[model samples]
Structures are given as C-alpha cells and as structure tokens.
Target: MPGKSLSERIADFGRRLAVEAHAAWLAARDPRTPWPARLLALAVAAYALSPIDLVPDFIPVLGWIDDLILVPAGLILVRRLIPRALWSEFHAVAAAASKHPSSRAGMAMVLLAWAAILYIVYWSVRVAPVH
Candidate 1:
C-alpha cells in the first residue's frame, strides 16, 4: 500500500500510544524506583501486559477503554502500596519522560527500524529461490 488507509493509520497510532503508556508504567515500577512506589509500578506494568483485561482489545471502541482505565487505576493502586514520598519521586521521573523529546524520538526510530528489518526478512524468506 502506498499509504495506510485512514482507519489503519488511526489504529496504528492508537496501538503505539497504548504501547508507550505501557512502557511508562514499566519504568515507573522499576525496583530502583522508590521503595514505596515500586510495587505500584510493577502492578500497573503487569496488568497492562496481562492477557486478561477489563475489556478485551478485540472489541470495537470499548476495547481500548481498558487501556485508559487500567493505567491510572494501577497508579492509584501503587500509590496505596507505597509511601507518599517515594510515589512523588517516581511521578517526577514519569513527568520528565513525558516531557523528553529525545526519548520519544529514539523509541519511535527503534520501533520503525525493527519493523523494517522484520519486513525485509519476511520478504527475503518468502521470495527465496528453491535449491
């Protein structure tokens, strides 16, 4: 396809955003994260990556609603698990990542490169001549 159809492009963008949110959740939960908030981060990351969901992604508009809900809910759950001071520190880091352009650009470039490499490998394998 010369360019993705509008719906395809939108779907791709939504998926990317969901992945980014998941990454942010993981970073927030790192053990090195303050003792207080570490568990919260872990819980959020686990839930985000988990196969189980409040609403499965296969559904129409309702599917992604889980992404919107789970992330914040996980954060709240983490906050309850940890002390306020530590949660503040992790939140600060999350805010910094959200503001950082280089990190976002790097992630996008890496994903694009990975996609390109996978496409090339698949194409080569499919078109390879028989011995």
Candidate 2:
C-alpha cells in the first residue's frame, strides 16, 4: 500500500492499542489470573483514561509520555497476573486484530462528524448573548 495519511495512521494505531489494552485487561481479570495483577491492571486503565493527568497533552513531547508509560506498564502487570497459556491465547488474538486492515475512510468520516458537532456547539456558545 501507498503511504498513509497521518490521521489514518494515528487512528489505526489507536484502534490497535485499544484492542491490545482490552485483551490485557481481560486476561488480568480472568479467574485464573492473580488478584494482585487484576487489581493493578484495573488501576492502570483507570488512570490512563482519567481526565486528570500528571502531564497534560498540551505539553509538547511530554504530553504523550504518559500513554507510552501507562500502556506497557499495564500490559506487564497483566502478564504477571495471568497464566502463560491464557496470555498466549490473548496475544494471538490481539496480533490478528492488529494485522487486520483498518477502514481509513470510515474513521475519517466519524472524526469529521465529531468535529462538525463540536464546531456547531462552539459557534452557538459564542453567538449566544449572556442573560
């Protein structure tokens, strides 16, 4: 395939990351998984998705550092929790999903719609007079 647009690449990476994170979380929570590992994965996911952050995204390169740290850390914690067999199974699934082709056009359309909605909301807020 030809070179992908930045947005498409980002979206594809985001989707794959989400898939891997979800698998890791599930494996960590399996009954066969150790309680300590499960708890750690839960905590990590919560922190990663939380609105509050140690470093805000507006801070240049540092903004994304949390993501780099959190994701791998969470996976490591999960691996420690789950059995080797189960983890191997989940890893296979995640690998398959990553190899699957992503629909760039569909993702772009969804992003555009979201942007349009946000723009409309911003326009309305700006034009509305304070009571």
| Model 2, span 64-128: residue lDDT tens | 88777766677676777777888787667766663433334334544666678889999999999
For model 1, the local distance difference test gives: 0.58
TM-scores of the candidates are 0.39, 0.52
lDDT of 1 by residue, 1-131 (tens): 59889899878865544454454464564665565465555455555544455455789989877676656566556667656665566556544564422234334444666678889999999999989
Clashes counted in candidate 1 amount to: 2
Query: What number of clashing residue pairs does each candidate have, in the order they appear?
Result: 2, 0
Local distance difference test, per candidate?
0.58, 0.64
Q: Every model's Cα RMSD, please? A: 12.0, 10.1
User: Which candidate comes out best when scored by TM-score?
Assistant: 2
Candidate 2 off by > 4 Å: 88-131
Residue pairs with clashing backbones, model 1: 29-41, 40-78
| lDDT over C-alpha atoms for residue 67 of model 1 | 71
